[model samples]
Target chain A: MKLATPRRLILPGLAVAVIAGLLSLLAYPFPDALEDSLESHRPETKAAEEAGPRPSSEGSEGWSAPLPDYSVPGVKSEGLGGALAGILGATGTFLALLLLLHVLKGRGRRGPNG
Target chain B: MHIPDGILAPHVWVPLAATGAGAVAVSARAARKRLAEESVPLVGLMGAFVFALQMVNFPIAAGVSDHVVGAGLLAVTFGPGIAVLCMAAVVTIQALVFGDGGIAALGANVVNMAVLSTLTAWAVHQALRPAFPNLAVAVSTVLGVLVGAGGAAAWVMLSQPYGAKFLGAMMVTHLVSGLVEAAVTLAVVKALRASGLVPGDARVVAR
Candidate 1:
C-alpha cells in the first residue's frame, strides 16, 4: 500500500477545511436538545441530582482536549480561532487517521505477501 | 448527536461503550478484508472530509443545529464496514482532540452516529436501490441521521428529566436535518460517481 503525498492529500483537505472553518462562523451556538433538556431538570430528579453534583467543570474530571469546544486557545477572534481550530483539527485528523489506515493496510499486505 | 460529559448514568454510557468497541472491532476486520490497497487513501480522505463537514452545523430549528454526518455517503461509497470505521474515527477525533463530545459519552456517541447510522443506511439503501437509486440514496441518508438521533434521544431520556420535550425537540429538528443531510449526501454521491472516484465495484460488505 502507498500513501498520498502531502500535497495530494493536504490540498483537497485544506480546501474543504477552509470552507468549513469559514462557514462554521455562522453556525448557531445555542445549547442543543440534550443540553437544554439537561438544564430543565425537574425537582423530582432526586435520583439524578444525588448521583453527584454536576462536575464543576465539564472536562475537568477527565483528560481535557487541547481544543476544548473546538476553539483555539488564546486567540482574540472567536470566529477566526474557531476557523483555525477547525482547519487544524481537520489536518490533524487526516494525518492521524491516515497513519492508522496505513498501519492497517500494511498489516493486510503482510498477511499475504510479506 | 454530541452527548457531553456529566450526563448519562454510568450504567448507560458504559454498556454503550462496550457495544461501540465491539462494533468497531467488527468493522475494522471487515474493512481489512474488503478494502483494496489503493483504497486506504480513499478511506482516510473520506474520514477527513466527514470531519471537516461536521464542523459546519446547520440550524434546523429555533435553538438547535445539526451537521452533515456523511454516514450514508460513506456507506454508499465505500461499504458499511468502512463507513462505521470512518465515522468512529471522526467521532473519536471530535471528542479527544476537539472536545466536541464528552469522554464518558464517546461510546454512546459512537453507537448513535457510527454503528447505527451506517447499518441503517446500508440496509435502507439496499432495500431501495432496486427500484430507484437516487431515492434510495436520499432515503438512506435521511434514515441514517434520524435513527442515529433516535439513539441519542434514548440516552438523553435515561439521563435527563424532560424526555418528552427532548424527544420532541430532537425528532422535529432532526427530521429537517435529515432532509438536508439527504440532499447533501445525494449530491456528493452523484459527484463521486461523475468523477469516478468511487467505482461501482468498490461498495462491499453490508456489515
Candidate 2:
C-alpha cells in the first residue's frame, strides 16, 4: 500500500479552521449549564454554610489557565483574543491528532488500513 | 460539558482519570488496527472541526446555552474508537490549552464527552440503521448527547452535593441542545457525503 498524504483535505481543513475561528467570535457569552446552576445556587449554599460548616468549593484553588477563559494574553479586544484562541485551538487540535495517528501508525505494520 | 477545575472532588476525578486513560489507550489500539492510512487526515480534520464547532453555543432556553459536542457526528462518521480518539484530543486541548475545562476534571470530561457519547451514538446508529436508515443518525445523535450529559451529571453528583434539581435542569437543557446537535450533525454528515469527502464504498462503522 502507498503511504497516504492529505493533499485533498488541506484546503478544506484550512477552510473549516478559518470558518470556525471566525464563528467563535459570535459564540454566546453566557455561562454553561453547570456554571449557571452553580452560580444560581451560590447564595443558598452560602446561607447554609453560615448555618453549618461545609466542604470548600475550591476544586483547584489558585490555579490559572495559560489562556484563561480562551482569551489571549494582553489582547485589548476580547473578541479578537477569543477568535485567535479558537484558531489556535483548532489548528493545534489538527496537528496533535495528526501526530498521534502518525505515531500509532508508525508503531504497527503498514497495511491498506494501517 | 467542560466542568471547570475545582468542581469535582479528588476522589471523583482521580479514578476517572485512570479509567479515561485506560479507555483512551484501548481506543488508540483499536483505531491503529482498523483505521485506513488514507483516512488519517479525515480524523484530524474532524477533530479540529469538532473543536471549532464547540465554540459556537446556541441558546436553547431563556438562560441556557450549549454548543455542539460533535461526538455523535464523529461516531456516526468514523466509528466509536476513532471518534473517541478525536474527541479525547479535542477535550484535552480544550482543557490544557484553552482552559475551558478543568485540568483535574479532564478525565471526567473525556469519559463523558468522548467515550460515552461516541460509543452510545455508534451503538444506536448500528442498531437502528438497518431498520431506519434515515432517522437512525438523528435518533442516535440525540441519545448520545443525553447519555453524555447524564454521565456528566452523575459524576458531578458523586463529587458534589449539586442535588437532583441540578441533574433535572442539566437533562432538560441538554435535551434542547441535543436537538440542535442532531440538526447540525445531520447537516454536516449530509454535506460530507455530498462533497464526497467520505468514500462512497467505505463503511465507516465497520472500520
Candidate 3:
C-alpha cells in the first residue's frame, strides 16, 4: 500500500485540530449551563425541600458532599483563552507529528527501500 | 465525559493516575514492536480523526450530550498499544488545550476510556477470534463500546457519593451512547477492511 505523504496528511490533520479547538471553546459555555441545570435539579436539594430542614447534627458537619463550583468569574475571557490554547496546542502537536513522520520517511527511503 | 478539575475526589484521581501510568508504559513497549514506521503518520491522523469525532456530540435525554469514545475502534484497527497511545494523546489535547477536562482528572479519564476500553476490546477480540474470525472485529468493537461506557459509569457512580437516581441516569445515558459508538466502530472497521487499510486476510494481520 502506498503510504500517505506527510505533507498530504498534515493539512487535513491541522484542519481537524483547529476545528476541534474551536468546538471546545464554543462548548465551554455549555458546561456552565449544564452545571446550572444539574444544580437546580440536584437530588439532594430536592430531597431537602421535600423533607423539612434537619437539625444541625455534629456528625454531619464533616460529611458534606463535595460538589464542584462551575461558575466562571469571567466567562468571555476564559472561553476565548481556552479556545486559543486548544487550537494552538493541537496545531503544535499535529506539526510535531508531521515532522516526525517526515524524518522517518527520509530514513526509510535511505535504508533498504533505496 | 471529561470530568473537569476539582470535580473528582483526589483519591479517585490518584489511583486512576497510577493505573493509567502503568497502562501507558505497557502500551508504549507494545507499540514500539507493532507499529511500523509508515504507520506513524496514519496513527497521528487517526488521532486527529478521533479528536474531531469526539466534538460531534449527540444530545441524550435530559439535555445532556454524549460523544463517541473511539478507543475500541482504534484498538481493532491499530492494535491495543497504538490505540491506547492515540486515546491518551487525544485526551491530553482535549484537557490541556480546550480545558474540556480537568488536568488533575486526566489520569482518571485516560484509565477509564483509553486503557480499560482498548484492553477489554483486545481481550474480546482474542477470545472470539477462533470461532467467529470474520466477526471478531465487529464483536470486539461492540464489546469495547459497552465495556468502556459501562465501566466509566461504574467508576463515576463509585467515585461520587450520589444517590441511585443520579447513578441510574448516568448509566442509562452512557448505555445509549455506547450503542451509537458500537455502530460507528463497526462501520469504520468494515470500511477499513473493505478498503484494505486493515488487511482482509485476518490470519496475516492477527499474527
Candidate 4:
C-alpha cells in the first residue's frame, strides 16, 4: 500500500474535476430518479400539496443556497452559469476531500518534540 | 436520490442524518487503518471522477433520469470504507455547493446517495464475485441502485403515510435506470483496470 504524493494525485483529480464540470453542462434538464419519484407521489389532495413545500413555502424558503440548483447568482445564461457552477462544484469537492484526507492522514503522526 | 429539506419530517431526517454522520465517522476510523500514501491519490482522484460523473444525468422512463453513482466502482476498486468516505464528500458538496439536496435533509442524501449505495454494491459484489465473476459488477451496481433508491423510498414512506404507494414507482423506475448504472460502472471499472489505475478484481487492499 504505497501512497502517491498530493502532487501526483492533483493531475488526475483535476482531470476528473474538469471532465465533470464539462459533462455537467450536458446533464438532463429534467428531474432525476429520486426527484421524479417524489413528483409521482404528488399530493392526492390540493391541500396536501399546499401543506408541503411550495414556491413560497416552508421548505423552499427556509434554506437559501448560494448556488441554488447549481446556477451562479446573477448569471442569466443557463449554460454558462451551470458550467461555472459545475466546475466550481467539482473542483470544490476535490479540494475539500483532499483537505479532509490530509487531516485524516495527519492524525496521531505528531512527533513527541512537536 | 437526493431528498430535499421540506419533504421529509424531522423525525425521519434526523435519525437518517445521524446514522449517516455516525457511519462516516466509523468509516473514517476504519479507513485510517488502511490509508496509505499510495492509496491516497487513487481514492482522491476516484472521488473526483465520481463527483464529476454524478453530474451527467441521462434520461429514463416515467419522467425519471439516471446518472453514474460510481459507488460500485469505488467499493470494488478501493473497498467499502473508502467508498463511503468518498461518497460523503461528493454528496455533501452537492448539497452545500450545488443545492442538489436540501441542507436540512443532508443526512438522508448522504445515506441514500452514498452510504447504502456503496455498502450494498460492495456486499453484492463480494457475494457474487466467487460465482458470477463476469456479471458481478453489473449485478452489484444494479442492486446498489435498488438499495439506494429503495432505502430512500422506504424513508419517505415511513415519514409520509401516502408514501408507501409510490415505493413501487421508485423501484420500477430505478430498475430501468439500474441497467444504465450497471453499464456505466462496468465501463468505468474496465477503463480503470485497463489504465492500471485499479487492480484487476483484486480484493480490497485495505480489507
Which candidate leads the pack in lDDT?
2
Candidates in order, TM-scores: namely 0.88, 0.90, 0.70, 0.89
Q: Summarize candidate 3's per-residue lDDT along A58-85 as a digit string, tens digits.
A: 2223333221121133445655655555
Poorest 10 consecutive residues by lDDT, candidate 3 chain B: B198-207
Task: Please write out the lDDT profile of model 2 over residues B1-207, one tens digit for every residue.
Answer: 878766677899999999899999999988888888788888888888998899988777666678989989988888888889999999998877777777788899999999998899989998988888658889899999999999888887776666778788778888888988999988888877766777422264226
Q: What overall lDDT, based on C-alpha atoms, would model 1 receive against the true structure?
A: 0.77
- Which residue pairs in candidate 1 have backbone atoms (N, alpha carbon, C) closer than 3 angstroms, thus clashing? none
Candidate 2 residue-wise lDDT at A36: 69
Residue-level lDDT of model 3, residues B35-128, one tens digit each, is: 6775577677777667666765665544566777787677777777777877887776666555555666678778877887788887887787
In terms of lDDT, model 2 sits at: 0.80
Query: How much lDDT does each candidate structure score?
Result: 0.77, 0.80, 0.61, 0.76
Please, what are the lDDT tens digits per residue for candidate 1 over residues A9-71?
555666677655887777778765445545544325677567642423443375878988888
Better of 2 and 4 by TM-score: 2
Which regions of candidate 3 are displaced past 4 Å?
Answer: A1-114, B129-135, B201-207
| Local lDDT at B7 for model 1 | 70
Locate the minimum summed-lDDT window of 10 residues in model 1 chain A. Answer: A51-60
Q: What is the lDDT of residue B122 in candidate 1?
A: 86
- Flag the better candidate by TM-score, 2 or 3: 2
In order, the candidates keep a fraction of the true contacts of 0.47, 0.58, 0.12, 0.62
lDDT per residue as tens, model 4, A57-91: 23445557788887899999988888888777777
B164: Cα error in model 3, Å: 3.0
